[model samples]
Structure formats: structure tokens, C-alpha cells
Target chain A: MNVSRRYFMILVPAAAVAWESVLAGTPEDSPNYKMQDHWWGMLIDTPKCIGCGNCVRACEAENDVPEGFFRTWVERYHVTDENMENPEVISPEGGKHGFPAAKEDEGKYFFVPKMCNHCADSPCTQVCPVGATFVSPDGVVLIDQSYCLGCAYCVQACPYGCRYINPEKHSAEKCTLCYHRITKGLTTACCENCPTGARQLVDLKNPKDPIHAFLKTHSVQVLKPQMATGAKAFYNELDGSVR
Target chain B: MAIFKDTGHLFRFAALFVVGTTSIFVLRAIVTPKSFGQYGHYRGAALKDLADRPVKYAGHQACEVCHTDIVTTKTAGKHAGVNCEACHGPLAKHADDPSNTPAKLDTAVLCVKCHAASAAKPKGFPQVQADDHSGGLACDTCHKPHDPAIAAGGAK
Candidate 1:
């Protein structure tokens, strides 16, 4: 059928908007992106992290995270002489830029990068009344923002304090483990931007991924093992004082 | 089949039950998404919703295609492993469109960002107190921004 220019012009703008919404709700094919073959996790060598805040800044830019809230941030653990088990932790401005200079030379200091643990046994997913927050087959805990009630149940349920209600979206949001990039076989924005290779995205199922060798040799600890949320974000050289 | 003696009232009650249950089934079919339980309790299509988002940083390889010379220089220097986006910021548009050149960088502010001294940083990560170190001079004045150790030994 032949179409007139007037109808064609009207259809073009409408189609563009409609197409994006359709794609957002539907499943699109990503070649070679197998869910069963991989289980996503992260590795952090805290000793190697320079506290440059590059990872934090990169995550915000890549994910378009709102200011005054973070999808990921760095905390400076100021271990003072007074207390060792409980270090004074501060994350100034979500540690988007480097932290302030240290005032005392008494005790040691270290930086810990924080994001969603993407736990296997996730409390956030369990408490979500709407089933909005859930664990993907690839083992990354994600939120279906479209289905989310914005009740902040997951935010309160999370032991790590990772989830937050996005001020703009008015939806509960946290790290998707950079799902958009990782599913395409690309490393996360934070891992890509880290200068010292301090943070690495690990695929637990991949036999040749080198994290297996490292895990075998190194002593790795997940935050708050006592809570037993089965958090997957692993930290090496984790101080006994860090919480 | 003939257990109930009051057949009229029982038939009406059975029909009401069937209609109520059928209506609920129809409502569920209408309200539910197509790919809701394809994987698990969550909507499986949410994975695609997530994966469909644009990859902002084009990765370091994207920079290597156009700027081979710069990549080579960086590879030879202390900044070898650092991503081009680490300093230049996300330039996915610039990489896609040749005409969309990124803005010029300021070595003054950029250099001190990572190099500034802090107790949390590694003890020997080539940090310096910016005020005492720079002496009101741009970092590039004495050191090459890419290959920092080239000009006058950027490190102590």
C-alpha cells in the first residue's frame, strides 16, 4: 500500500517512543549471554585500593545514579587507638572524590568499596512483598523496577544497607551488578575504571577465571558472615576490625 | 450424583462456584505478564530490560582504534593499565562520532585527584602533598601527563 507523507511524519515520532517502551518490557536476545554457564560475583583486594574514588565516580556516571545517593561507594575505615574491633567508618560525599587528609598518625586506615553483595540467599529478595527484588539465574540479585511497589521493604531488609529508594524514580534501586554490561560479556564500570586492578568482576562457574586459583590460596571474607545472607562480594586482606 | 435431595439449590450453588472460579482465572490471565514465570518468581523479561540499557563507557579498546599513538604512549608509561575513560571521562559519543571531540583536559586538577597524599592509600603509591609538591606550577610543567616519569622523573 502506498502511504502519504502526512501519515508517515505522524507515525515516525510515535513509533520511536513506542519501540523503546516495548523493548524495555520484552526480552531481547543477547548472543552468547548464557545465564546457566555463569554465576556473577566480585573480588576486592582492599590493600590494593588507593582510595582515589575512581570506581565510585565511574559507577555514578555509567549508571546515572542520583547525587547524594549511591549505587556504590567507598568507606574510609579510620582505626584509632581507642577501638580496634569497631573502626570509625566515614564515607564523605559517598567518596565520589578522594577523602580528606588524615588528621592523626596513630592507627591504620583502609578503604573498602561497597555495592550490592548479589547474595545467593538474599534477604532483600525474600522480604520483597511484590516479588520485585529477586535473584537472577546468573546469581545476581536484581530489582524489577516496573514491578516494585517502592515500599522500601528490600531497603530495610538488606543487611549491608546497599538498597535505597531512587529519589527521582521513586523506586527501590541498588546495584544491578552492572547487569547491562556484564550480560554483554563486559566488565562492570567500577571494575573497568579501577586503576590498580583492586576490584574484579568474578564468574564463579568459570573454571579458568583465575578467581578459583586466588580463592584457593587467599583468605577471602564476605562482610557479616554471621548474618548468613550468603553475600558474594568477597574481600581479601579484610581487617578483623572492618564491619 | 444423586447424593443431595435438594437438587435445584445445589445446582445453582455449583454453577455460582464455577463462574466465580472461571472469572478469577480470566482476570489472572489478563493481569499477568507473558514472561512472568519463564525463569523464576521474578519476571524473566526484567533481565532483558536490564541488558537493553546502553553501555556508556565504550571500554579502553574503543579508544585504541582511533588514537593508536596515544594508546602506545600510555602503554609505555606508568599509566599503562589505566583506562582512557579514567581521565577523559565517558566518551561513548565521541568514540561513535568523529566530529564529537572530547573537551581539553586540565592537568592541574586531574593530576592531583589520584596523586594526592592520603593515609588510606598505599604507603608507596607515589603520592605527594599537592601544595608543597607543585609549588604553584602545573604538573605537566615538569612531567609528561601520559608518561609521567619521562620529563624529570615524576616519581620520588
Candidate 2:
């Protein structure tokens, strides 16, 4: 076939773009898994947690998280009986090392495991100048790292203080709730390593999930509910004093 | 001929508008990723990028398939809920390659990492002072890791 120079240039570029999509092939680890069928979230049972720091350690190893940062961390809250509102909380080294014995054998002490709340009305998504951060179809908020501007807008917008800029990559990083693992019919690193059944990755759409039943019976609360971010990380026996 | 000359400026402005709009559309079509806006506002392929990324921790169920003896012991113990990878670290590679065994971890140090007395821990949960619990002896010396309450000899 005879082609003019103008037509040839257009044809080559068009073919190049088409070829890239063909190579992409929509490859997924679990090809049969459907995102629409699931709405992902997490459950934290505070009473069950032993504060062993297993979840924190497992997340770092699983995600290749840099040192002095955390994807998930345990915070110890020591609330006095008299002044419940004035609780002393500490998360040294992102709770990687278990805390020392309590100096004050006071009113009540417990560990609160914290991670990205994966809000439905996420401020992080709203503030992204490039819209690199967005909500996934399965109700999980995710970041397209390649498109991220590393402006740290998401880091600042997050009320839970979950998001942080990866020092080396300089991109906003937070808990994905282990999207890579969950899509492949696996639980998160944090939930999997939790020895006491303190954490469980919940599929809100799945009727069989125990979360639905647990929610019915328990008083569930998200951190900073006043912000009204629709945070999906549910906490059972959440102390009113927790900040 | 008189009408054409009078409306020449208007025609020129219309032509520029057409050309400018067409070029903008072409530029967007060229630069935009094929998968953009396929799922949401972001690139659709990002979802696949995450879903396809390799995992390090082979769930405890994977280990149970091969090491039934060890897993059986663990399942019947205080640490039954603890996944194998929690203590073993990421062993997805080892699960595939039998030759690539995980390094022998020091039980003394490993046990203390979790069991050491922590103020933050729940009261019902077990805690110990490493020095007081053992006179510099490995935890596994007396307490079987799989079943901590049981002695190494299968005696409680």
C-alpha cells in the first residue's frame, strides 16, 4: 500500500499508543476477583490487643517501609480515673519496640493500633493538585505513585495523621490496608500477624463478614469522628479519651 | 465581493477558534494515558499495579500445607492465632524454593521481643522480665515454642 509521509507519521504514533494498551493486558494476580463485589475496611478490637508490636513489625517487613516511619503503629494511652480527658499517650519508635513496665499502676491503660482510616470523603483526595490520590471502586482510598506530585498535600489533609511523605521517594505513603494482598484473597500484614485477633480486614459488602454482626452489638467509633471524613477503620471499645 | 471584505475579521477570528480548539483536543488525546479515567479520576492501571505486586508473607495456611507437624503443634498452643510469617518474617521466597531455608533465629532474643514486660500491654496478657524469667537461657530450652506451656519433653 502506498502512503504519504503525513499519513505514515500519524499511523506509527497511533500504533504505538495502541500497542502499549495491548501489552498492559489488564493483568491481575487474582483474575477472577471483582472489585465491585467488595468494599474493604478494617476492625480493631482494642480489648483483644496485647500490644506485642507484631503488626507494626510485620507491616515494615512486608511493605519495605523505611526506618523511623510507620504504616501501622500502636499507641499506649494511660488515662487516669480522675482526669479521663487528660490521657497520656506515647508511641516511641512507632511502637516497634514493646513499651517498658508501667511506672504508674494507675486507672486504665490500653494500646490503640493506628493506620490510614481510608475515608470515604477523604480530604487527601480532595486536596491533591494532580488528583493522584483517589478512592478505589472497592471503597479503599489509594495513591497512584507514578502520578503523585509529592507536594505532601495529602499528608497535611489527613486528620488521622496516617499519611507521610516517604523520605527517599518523596511521595505520600500510608496504609493501603494491604490492597495487594486483599485483592488476592489474603488479609493484610497487620491483621495476619495480630496474634490475639485484635485486627481483621473486613469486607463491608460481604454479608458473611463478622464485622456486620460485631458492629450491630458493639459501639464502633473512628478516630476524630468530628472531622466527619467517613473513616472506615472501626474501633470497638474505643475510649472517649482517645485523641 | 463587498460583503466578504466587510466580514473578513470575523471569519479570521472564527478560523482561529476552530484551529485552536482542534489542536487542544489533539494534544490531550496524545498526552492522556489510555487507562486514565477507566476506573476513577486516577489511572486505572494503578489498581492493577498494586494488585499485581508480589507479596512477601506467605499466609500461615501456605506453610501448613508442607509443615503439618510444626503447624499442628502451633495450632494447639497459646500462639495458635499468630501467623507463621509474623515470627518467621517474609518467607514467600522460601515457600517456593525448598533450598532457601530461613536463617536460624535466636529464640532467646526473638521470644523477648514480644514477651518482655510492657506497660502498654493488656493486663490479662502474659508478660515477663527476660532476666528474671531465664538466667540467660534460651526460652526454647525449657518452653517449647510451638506450645509454650508444655516443656520440651511434651510435659506441662
Candidate 3:
């Protein structure tokens, strides 16, 4: 007996629909589905940040971040096209006082907080031979220190140079987006303490989050978008000339 | 011939078991929360509400109500972005009793929890080895949280 190709095609889709319906109705014993597509991210408004470096201190205090190392750091961008050769980006050793004095030029200056961009297409995650580095369902990039061979592949693969191997822990380390705090339902240490609310942790899935609305209303751009790692961290008011 | 067939079946079973055991080990590595990798799974208060649903935490604003001066100084200083709760353990107890002894954000103890001394120090920051910095030095000994200036005030 020959079966019609149309009938077989219809049967496959129908069976798939039935299977999906059954799975949908069945409550998952292990709720791993809730962990999907979570990308914890930040929106830094340079115009509002005021160069106070409060976020830096707050991050240190919150996560007990050590001296001489940073989970979250700030970068001060100075644009001087008039003397293009002399134009430079100055990140005065510590970000505590924000940016150092910009030279007397018609150029512009702004403070940009830098950390793991937590790209969705994260190069750090891709280069981990031991699978120590990964992106969370919520979109934060993380390192599993125990599994980390400390091979430093993640460090090299990262174009932004965010990853570093901690010699003390004998493992790789990077900004965690305050995972311990954020998981406990607290705002990220940096976001909560931002006096001017210049920095914000946003849920891309939540339409109510002011960040979603802001992105929709404004033309915010991600850094190094050309790398096409699809960074979750977005910035507003950065001059196109700065890049 | 029957004995040979039986031996072959046993060999296949053993191979399957070995593969299964190896797979379980690999899966464990993938699923385990190793180091800061688990940070990506940070489930903020709102998301936690969707999970087990009982945990609660206070925002910095709640602390600022009573810590007005501390909060003011913190906001105006470099430490403004640092939350009162970050240094202080938890606020619920303090919120419940405003007179409760609060935690201090001072010292290398605060810094060491995260910024552990690397075998090699980065730039101007001093080496914070487990033993060297493990002793009496507080974070404030060399650096000020509110100001970038190295504190001559020393660790209190």
C-alpha cells in the first residue's frame, strides 16, 4: 500500500503538535525552562554619570572585590580631533576620582564604565577548552573556577580583554554582574549604589523595565558592535566620533 | 557459537555502561556551578520571587532613611555607588532594630573577599597575598573608599 506524501507530512506536524501540547500541559519536575534567555545587562548613561566613581567603590564593598583588581572598572574617553595624533583616552590609574583633567582643547570628555560586556555570542565562552567559561541563560558571562584549567584561552579570545586568570584562586576570573546579589533578588551592587542612577541593570525580557522603553525611544548603541558578539551592555549618548 | 554470542552481548552491555558513566561525569561538569561562572545565573529579587518566593532583601534606600549622614557622605564621595547593604551584611535585622550594631566596610578583609592578591600585583596596588595582607592591614590602610587618595589615616 502506497501512502500519500501529503498525508505523511500532515501526520508528522500533527504528531509534533500533539507532543508539544502534552509537554506544555505537563509541569516540568525540574524547572530548567525558567533559566532560559536571561541576559543580565547594564545601561550606562555617560551624560549622567558625573565621574564620581561611586559605582567602583560600591562594587568593591558589595562583592568584597580586592585591591588592584576590579570586577567593574571605568574608562574616561577624551576625544581631540584637532590634534588627532595627540588625542588619547585617559583612564587615570584608579577610577575613584573619575576622569583626570582633560587637556584644554575643544574636544569632549565622558566617563564610560567598562566591564564584561557579557556578549551573547561571547568569544570568552567559545574559547574555553574545558567549558569553564559560559554565558548564563540570563546572558551574563561567567567562569567556573573549579573547571577552569587556567589555560587563559578565554582571556585571549576576549577582544575587550576583560578576562583574567586569578593566580590566588588558580582560576580565571571576570566581572560577574554581581551574580550572588542579583540571584538573591537584590539590585546589582553597582546599580543600587549609583547616586545619579547613571548605571542600571536591566531585564531585556521585561518591557516594564525603563531600559527597554529607553532603548525603544532612543538610539542607544553597543560598543564594538562590529565584532558581532552581540554585546548585551548598551550605552546612550556616546559620540560616534569616539569610536 | 552460543557461548560466543553470549560473550558478545556482555561486551556490548559493558561498553554501554562505560559510555553512560563517562557521560554522567561530563554532564556533572557542565551543570556544576564553578567559580564566577555561576554569576551569569544571577537571579535578582524579582526573578527569585518567581522561584522559591520566600526570600526578601532591602534596598539601599531603606538603609539611607536612618543612615542619612552616612548616606549623604557616601553619595557625595567616591563610594556613593556603593550600597549601604553591600558592606553591611543584611538590612532586615538593622531595619527591624535601628539600634542594631552595623557591619563595617573597612579593611583588606572587605577587599580580600573579592580582590584577592594575585601572585603578581597589578600596578600601584600592593600585593595582598593570603598571609601578607591576611594580617592586620585593612583596605583603608592604603586606599580610601570614598576618596582615591592614599589614606595617611591608616587602618583604624
Error of 2 at B139 (Å): 0.8
Over A1-243, each residue of candidate 1 has an lDDT whose tens digit, in order, gives: 887999999999999999988876634487688798899999999988888899999999999898888888999998876658668898998889888887558789989998899999999999988778899999999999899989998899999999999887899999998999998877899998998888999999999999999988999999999989888899998988887
Candidate 3, residue A157: how far the Cα is off, in Å? 1.4
Q: Write the per-residue lDDT of candidate 1 for residues B45-151, one digit (tens) a residue.
A: 88899888998888888888989998877888988888888888888888888799889888889987888887778887888887899886888887777778854
| Candidate 2, B70-125: lDDT as tens digits | 98788777888878887788898998887999998788989877777866676678
- lDDT, candidate 2, at A61: 88
Maximum-lDDT candidate: 1
Put the candidates in DockQ order, highest first: 2, 1, 3
TM-score of chain A of 1: 0.86
In model 1, which runs have C-alpha deviations exceeding 4 angstroms? A1-28, B1-7, B151-156
| Model 2, span A46-105: residue lDDT tens | 988777788998899889899988989999889886758789898888888766667547
True contacts kept of each: 0.72, 0.78, 0.11
Q: DockQ of candidates 1 onward, in order?
A: 0.52, 0.54, 0.09
User: Where does the lowest 10-residue lDDT sum fall in candidate 3 chain A?
Assistant: A26-35
